[model samples]
Target: MAKITYIEHSGKRHEVEVANGLTVMEGARDNGIPGIEADCGGACACSTCHVYIDPSWVEKLPAKDSMEEDMLDFAWNPDPARSRLTCQIKVTPALDGLVVQLPEKQI
Candidate 1:
């Protein structure tokens, strides 16, 4: 399991272990962590699951696909450098200490 830390806009933090092969959004949803709405489940069809990856981990993650980039345009205050749809990020051992920051609201 990879340990992921979710930081809410209000500064609230939730740390949980997510098994490999699941998306980051799944970890948040299963743990009942607020912030990620995941309206489209893990389908990557919406921006409700958008989040800002910690700068230190940004280079460590995979590049965003064109579809993910397009969907982020619909997110609330997306940061091009750090924003990513949780559903697009697969959990892996390399992401054990991954940290993501949630936007103030989902649009």
Candidate 2:
């Protein structure tokens, strides 16, 4: 299992054990972590699952796709380099210590 750390806007952090092949949004939703609404259910249609990957681990994840890039434009606090849809970040052994920070607002 990979460990994921979710940091909230208020600076609260929660770590959850995620099974391989699971999406970051799924892990947060399953653990009842606030901030990631995932309104599109991981279909890559909504930006509600937006999260900021910690700079340290950003290089390990796959590059964002066109759809995600379009949706990210609709997200708050969009960081060209760090913004990503949690739904698109799959958990793998290589991403063991993934850390994602939630945006202040998820509209």
> Looking at model 1, how many pairs of residues clash?
0
**C-alpha lDDT of residue 42 in model 2:** 98
Backbone clash pairs for candidate 1 read: none
Q: Which candidate is the best by lDDT?
A: 1
Query: Model 2, clash count?
Result: 0
**TM-score for each prediction?**
0.98, 0.97
**How well is each residue in 57-79 modelled by candidate 2, as lDDT tens digits?**
88989999899999999998799
Q: What does candidate 1's lDDT look like per residue over 3-71, in tens digits?
A: 999999999999999999999999999999998999998788999999999999999999999999999
Q: Give candidate 1's root-mean-square deviation (CA, Å).
A: 0.5
Instruction: Name the lDDT of candidate 2.
Output: 0.94
